[model samples]
Target chain A: MAGNTTPTDFGNPVINWIDKRLPVFTMMQKEYGVFPTPRNFNYLWNFGAIAMVMLMVMIASGLVLAMHYTADTKLSFNVVERIMRDVDYGWLVRYIHMNGASMFFIAVYVHIFRGLYYGSYKQPRELLWILGVLILLLMMATAFMGYVLPWGQMSFWGATVITNLFSAIPLIGDTIVTWLWGGFSVDNPTLTRFFALHFLLPFVILGVVFLHIAALHVSGSNNPLGIEPKSDKDTVPFSPYYTVKDLFGVCVFLIIYAAFVFYAPNYMGHPDNYTPANPMVTPPHIVPEWYFLPFYAILRSFTIDIVIPFTDIIIISSKLGGVLLMFGSIAMMFILPWLDTSPVRSARFRPLYQKFFWLHLAVCITLGFMGAKPPEGIYTVISQICTFLYFAHYLIVLPLLNKYEKPLPLPPSIHEAILAQKK
Target chain B: MGNPHSHGAQCSHDAPQKHGQEECPDNGHDESKRDFIFISAASMAAVGTGVVAWPFVATLGPAKDTLALSTTEIDLSPIQEGQAVTVMWRGKPVFIRRRTAQDIELARKVDGDATAFNSLRDKQKDTDRVKQSTFGGKEMPQWLVMVGVCTHLGCVPMGQKPTDMRGDFDGWFCPCHGSHYDSAGRIRKGPAPHNLAVPTYTFLSENRIRIG
Candidate 1:
């Protein structure tokens, strides 16, 4: 049976169709070189390729899930359960899709931090990095909206509370909330809109990713040295070099991803979500998804209540502070390329900067942890300190240290750096 | 630098074999090509193994028969008149409700002619007798049982009380999308396209009943 086909026969309809419609292999050869890529790319570079693979996996699994899914609010949850229990290979598809979301975020976080460490956002690559950040935001939104479609208790109340956050705005807040809900409350109209947006945003992220890649291609990848290739002699073909590396990385990633899907599918899920949505009984503590915990913490940190001058309206002081801090965190990243005055590029060459960067990362993670926990007295105090440090690292220390700290001598080449380190 | 192709050169070939070195041009090309072929073959094998293993890994849970039989029967004894109880059958929700006088009256008065029983009889003449055996011949149905899953999405439909606008439903209200079903679990209003399914069942006694 296998003898009928040659390696280049391309008898498979998919292979034949691809060959006819596009120059996939040729493009791979030309742009990547027949064996394209820098020979020395490290694990940090693996995430982008891993993310692409994850995107494909998520889309494939999600498509299968959508086939068995009922968009109607009443049956949506049950249909999801059916997909988990009844349809052929449905459980596999659902687990993959669900875990794929978590894996996507994991890869993306690592990808973003890799860019940060290598200063991939410097100079011409800033726009590419910014676009990547936008893609991250869009992804968060898509995941949030998709989570609500299950229509479980958490899905419903989470949607209701999150959508109601718009009411925190001034005069138009209530109107905006109503418009978002497509009704006076979170009902069928809200579910329909959430579904539509969830379906639509992935394509938006895809388009943004295209632009992100376009930007990356123009600048090329930043190496650990953060120096441009001096000549063709310095650069290697991308294909066999990076492709094999990326494939290995993907295999390792899949092992971890599979463990989560098979062993603890509900580890990241909220327990209250198992119950059906009951609008009358609010869940004791309303928390967003794990990914959104940091921001949720930031939103809850303020303790004051502010009354509009000469008006009866009163607003919680902490929520406003939290909102500002959240925006500040993201907005700070946009200005990072200009904020630091250090002559050095990579974090490896900047000892003080590296220390501060690690400290800031720790603070962000601590804030995220505190966000998920209830705001008791001690937790509140710790969150306040961490939140303060998170802002201080970006707003004050980074800029000031950039001027004062003396960076280490730069290596002319990665090869020289490695040799020097060995000696 | 040592000759690139010297049989025992100390300079490693792991580095990109530089040209204009002692190595023969043809030998360098052949070596690289061989490396490419080996790497490609290894990658293909790994990918093939992954693809084959995915299904088995995903299906590590119980077998089909075990999962099917995991469904447990629920008792409907405590369900008072005008009350409903939700039970699990085949991992999907099944609702059992006992109808009140007004519910039966409203169901009978629905199209002015009370011909639903006749229509049901006409549709399943052979199965009618067997199906009717459970309900018996009381003028009012003391109990109504159905899968709580919405025909549209499978949400558990809430039992609407007789007095509330939802209670006027005489059956159940699915809050997920506002689909309403009548006393007989027939889709009455909203987006549900099919009637709520009734599971295979046998009543053990008056109050105690078993559902499969």
Candidate 2:
């Protein structure tokens, strides 16, 4: 006790006693307390913390809703309605989950874009960025499954359409689809399994999130300047500085999240989802949620089969092409570090990329807009162009910028930048 | 050569020792025996884990009742000409339409015409689309039976109801992606690559039919 070498130097006797044995307290202090973080973080830096809060909100609310919701094709829809109507504060719990998904995406998309703007995916932090991408994929999967749980018209048709995409594969595609559905079509069995997996996946996301943070801790955070914290002057302890900033950020985010939960709970959801799933009647226009719009646009963009020119043979069917491109769009982010080989970390320093970043973002937003429109006439054409631009941004534009763009001189350090601004 | 389990080997110590550093727990005389124990232990554990994991993985496949395919018996007698009814077959909508005289004539015309039949996405004869069944003691081909789901993305076509929009083909229209099926239930336009699928069925007698 006299020669305590343990880093858990909490003045409290109980924590110190337990820290020597388990060292859990020491870990918290090391990772979240005395952890050195960049002092010059902007509001965008707050989103990672915001996303973490939304995950907990989703899990907690989802757990309570899961207690009341039935996963049967017949009952799942009514059960959700009942939860909104009968179960005590079930509306609140369900609404939180419903809107929490949107908020989570809002935070994560900002978090990811922030990563893109800064070169957070560069070198040592590539693993950290990759882990973040994995979390995004898991979140997408979980959210898709969760959307199906309500068993609404959109839920049924959406599940049917999305699962049927698997059938586009040349061989064993139908077999894979049959296995996924667990029956001839999306029915009770599919609902039950989706429910089971939906419940199981958030925890998986949580596990990956733990790894994301662990990797983040290893590489440390990427600030607005996108430079390493060279000295203590440039760095601030994570406890008071970041903890308070993150808390303030979450509080502001919660107000907006709460406004949606209270004033307009069902605003983010589809009206078609209110009707129970009817296989006999499909929605006039089948579309995915707002978060999935960009990829959905890409999926619909492939209208013609890629055929071998001047030959009878076909390269790939239109459906298969769309599926590949849709998935490829997500895979694009995984290879982004390799794609954008600019030595500069922050886009601010790279004058050309900074401007083109807006163009890429605009293309993505346009794709999302096109996704909501019926895949026809001018919409399909626009979707096709945007889809090309979406892939080309990473594949062609970024690499070209890496080679050609003349970057502005960077401040010596984060502290120097702050001092320079003052002067 | 002290017993490997004892401190004389010194290799298995929790901390590094100044003495007998080379003769650590891993360098014990029973190294071969220890490795055998470790390998067998790991193998058994891996096998045990896999054996335990089988049931959870297997449960995800089609359930026993789902695999037990059921046949749907439709009372087509009540259905009148030009009325299309959807019956649940294997949890999917199976459209059974009592074709009107005009509908039959149009379908037969397409079958007789060489150009139209060749133009079909899935070129099956119109005669092939309908099955011969007895009604009023006459061999008749009045009913057009096919899976109601759209071939593009599995949305049920809208021509089953009197008010719904039947695409120019006068068969059914899938509004989801604007796939137009001619009265023969063949894909005419839009994104759907194939005709509305015809399901296996047999006429029980006259107006009743059984579909799977």
- The DockQ of predicted model 2 stands at 0.49
Supply the TM-score for candidate 1. Answer: 0.62
- Residues B114-189, model 2: lDDT tens digits: 8876666567777877875455778667788899988777788889889999988899998766778988899877
Candidate 2: the clashing residue pairs are: B11-B24, B11-B25, B12-B25
Per-residue CA lDDT of candidate 2, range A1-423, in tens? 125446656899998888878888778878899999999999999999999999999999998998898888778888998999999888889999999999999999999989988889998888899999999999999999999999999999999999988988888987888888988899988999899899999999999999999888888998888789899999999999999999999999999999999999988889999988888788888888899999998988888756687553557767788889999999999998889888889988988888888888999999999999987789999999999999989999998987888889888999999999999
* Share of the reference A-B contacts seen in candidate 1: 0.00
What range of 10 consecutive residues in model 1 chain B has the weakest lDDT sum?
B121-130
Q: Model 1 - which docking category?
A: incorrect
Off by over 4 Å in 2: A1-6, A309-314, B1-56, B100-120, B132-141
Give residue A179's error in model 1 in angstroms: 0.4
**Cα lDDT over the full model 1:** 0.69
